[model samples]
Target: MTITINRLLLRADTADGPYGTDIVFEKGLFILRVENTHGKSTCINSIAYALGMEMALGQVTSKPPFPPSLLKNIQNENGTEIPVISSYVMLEVSNDRGQTCTLKREILGADAESIITVYESDIESISNNGRNLFIHLEGDTSRELGFYYWLAEFISWDLPLVPNNSGRESPLYPVLLFPLFFVEQKKGWSSIQATTPFHLQIIQARKRAFEFLMDMDINETVNSKAKNKKLIDDVQEKWKQIYTQLESVAIRLDGKAQGVKDAPAATFDPFKLDILIEHQGNWQSLTSALIGLRADLTQHVKASQPQVAEQKNESLLSKIRELNNIVLQEDSKYEFLLNEISFVKNQITATEVRIENLVDDKRKYEDLKKVKSFSILDDLPVLNNECPTCGREYSDHNVEIECSDDLMTLEESLEFIKSQITTFKSVLNSYKMQLDIKKIELSKLEKQIDKHGADISRLKTELYSERNVLDEESLREKIRLENQITEYEKGLVAVGDFRSTFDILHNQYKHLISLRRNFPEHGFSQKDINKLDGLKTKVVKYLSEFGFSSFDPQLLEISQDTYLPTREGFDLGFDTSASDGIRIIWSYLISLFSLREIFKTNHPGILIFDEPRQQEANKFSFTGLLKGASDAAKSGQIIFATSEEEDVLKGALEGFKYTLHSYSPSEGKILRKLNKGA
Candidate 1:
């Protein structure tokens, strides 16, 4: 759409110039080039106010051109201020078929005291050469499309992106993806495109841009979306995998949180996945440790039979085995101590296989960007591979840890188990060695005592024969030797160190059980211990696809068909690598994304932006941004405003299409198209 403004004219009752411009357009791209400090932003914003009630650009832009009962508040910035705003804007919307529509309006000044709500004259429209009429005012009315409704007619917008809504409105949302088309010095013009989720918003915006192209179904353009169809499908497939994984994760994860028995009524309900997922998140570590413990105990039972010590208490072993089964319960609380030697081992090969799959699935998510381009991607980046909130790098080949809760490594579990198993093996092996030595020592000791006792008996008999009488002294000495031999034999009856060895392992078994039960919130009940792997996959899938810190955690509160923002706030959704230079990016993105969406359905006759430079705003690279915005304006009509023309304005909109219009408060002139080489 080639839209133009030729020496825009605005008429003041007295000597002031006309408050409007003459705009024209043809085809889809702009024919005008905006120069630096070009006052282009103002023209854009005035155009926005001209078309809609809401602020399309920055603060002050939302205020009506005139204030209600203007005398009460009367000073500009020196603490005193008079409230004023344009009552209406006149526009001549023309189609290639030579169809033209004009709109003029009269507006009431806003309540000067009120900040909670304020609006200029709402839209008033005169269609197909009709007379000027009030759209929202009392009594004196004209049905020829109220200005506000007319604005809406040009752009049908959905708020908070009603996901459950029907038709094209479902896919619309705010975005800021202004592309740069510069006059390249060498190698022609090189386009360094953005690959981020922000593009999602752009698709929504371009959808609106397509509306003005010619009265055709813009959804047809989406068929081209099929060209990137494989990519989007892959994204969806990946998203589906992500979705399935998240759901499974919700199930497999430790159920620390309970499901809602009753939901409260509100315009919006937050998503409940986080609560369930959080519950699952809390139990992950316990799940892994239990698995290791189960493994170790099974090996113990299979490798050895109960010694005589255990045979005396078969019931004790039986009780221990019962505890082991608790770990198998769907909701059984796993707790401390000796699992039974009698219990048979169940293969949890699933956990291992799951872990491998998680590793693989996660790896695929990382490498997703490498597989394809957004063949139909028409706008700026939205979902950035890197976090726009935090400056973090994400490669196509590595899983983003911050995005998903269920995704985790065995780092903690492995570290813990390694220490435990090492000590267990050491103690078990040491006892085995000691027990063997003790058995041999007992044997040697017994034999020596037996031979010594016999020697003592012979000495006594030989001495008695020589003496030929009682021989009490010899008998006493022989008795002493015999007693000493008996004591030596008693000393060598085995130390029983094997029992001590078993006791140590028994404690480890008990400790592991205790850990799982005591930390129920973080502990997986026996039922969930086996579901850890499944839980990880699901959490990773969703988080990687859409979860975000700025994710408006309130997005989780969605319910029914409506939404009431859980918490109210504004943001300029820019990516991490964008630097401090891009803080303004989020607000711009949101405004643009929303603006674009509004443009699509209602298909507004014009677009607008107001004084957009923010405090702490770095102006570098902004010229190209404006240039792109202006080029985008060509599809319809665009206007923007700025208080200052710092160099950033020059950089942001370099080499783009736009009719340069200026607002001169000193000259009392506005909407004047700046003619170059004048």
Candidate 2:
């Protein structure tokens, strides 16, 4: 991608007349040379401002970066100050495909500072015809109406989404990239990417920006790794949920599942698991106990009958009849309790669903509140329940009676929903408690009915015959054994139904494990390695030529982990001298331009420097930087604004071909009053 700034026009409408400056840039190297305090930096800042990139210079604010000359007042050619009414900056830029567009922004006017008008034509054709785009608003980097979104497309750049510090994904905004190409005078010289906005919460933004500009494959690799890790996490979460559910079911059936792991494993065996129930104070496998109980029950049924005593026969028959009546009444009560429990369970489910829906609605309202905080749509009537077309208050369609004077605002509505959720949750807990009580009562009733039936069976056996009467103790033993058998059979059925789901859970766990193993162990692809190695070579070469004197220039290396300059596994910031630090910046930035020659990059092919020579570097070293920049300019454009003396500047540029825009002492300033025709 390529971005070439063709022209910059800064205009201020004052009481006397219009006051501004118009400068046209040509291909290759261009130098803006002027005396101190001559508005050189102003011209540079105007270009960035018009492009909606001033956030790269410093903290964003409503105020513009321009001085009073273009904002509050402007001095005429006669040195008389005039009041300024309004001011705006315009910049015309073209891409590698020769598609030209002019960007205009208001500094002091009725329009908000976030607004930028993009004219499809060149600077000369900029009139009232253009599309208005906004910056500094939410979604400004990814949405259609955002200035950066349009700018990226114009430069043919497909911006990638990168991870942010909050563990969420955000687009790599143009502001982060501008620090590389447009180095402001105040803070850009301090370090490499000194003005990168950390407030945006991008994780390792400096490193990510370098990777993007160089078009490294590491970005794709990182994204892939994150996605795979998320899948694995999701799978593990599901496994835990299923395991908990199985445990709950076992507990409800008065049995416990054994040998089942709670976490996902590649070698899990579902058939190894066992469901155990306590029978007569001893824990036994549910399936084995059911078989034993059935055998005992069959033996009891086939055993020979005993003769009954002649005098006790009537009493036995009477007792059996009474026990049967009791069992029938208990059975009827049990059925009614079952119906009540079912009704409560359904109600609990419906209440839970309603709570979920309310929670979702509350989340949406919270997001809407955040959007309103940006004040982007402050003028929209819908926010206040007023019709936009007719400018009338909207009626509450949900109101069924006379409307109340009080209406719930968004905050109130959120609070109301929260309270509703709390109340419903309390109600749900109450329902659960009631259900537990009913289940316990039902279990007791079942035991009572079983006891009564056992009594009746024992009494009936006692009345079998006068000659073959069964002893009362023996008859009671047979009835007790039969009841235990019936209960064991019921438990077996419940456990069997639960065991059927284990196969599906086990398969899902194994599939997730397989997917996890398929991902690459490391994130660095071969292409990423090549780019870093190539970048390291260029940086070392540039450092050597630029007189890097902090240590052995050959020992200086670019770190693979952070992509920053380092020496012997430590950063080179505090150890390097001030002058050498400046040289490092020069080498690092220029090497980016050099890398573009060999590798395809997203760099805009444009480099701007407010002052290249900082920290009083020797003339030879400065000359080496100029020579390096001149070589880089062969493929793109590089602009430098300097206060260096004419003779000294000329000596450094003696052998380099460049464009010079000079402002002498007599020229006074870069901004001047203009005539209507001029």
Please give the CA lDDT of all the candidate structures: 0.33, 0.80
Tens-place lDDT digits, model 2, residues 455-548: 7876766577555445574466678778766666665665455455655666766776676677666557787778778878888888888998
TM-score of each: 0.29, 0.68
| Runs in model 1 lying further than 4 Å from the true structure | 1-46, 52-63, 67-88, 95-98, 108-129, 132-134, 137-145, 148-607, 630-637, 643-656, 662-678
**What's the lDDT of the predicted structure labeled candidate 1?**
0.33
Q: Which candidate should be chosen as best, given TM-score against the real structure?
A: 2
Error of 2 at 45 (Å): 2.1
Clashes of each: 97, 6
lDDT of 1 by residue, 328-392 (tens): 43122111111211111111233344445555554554454343345553232333455556757
TM-score of 2: 0.68
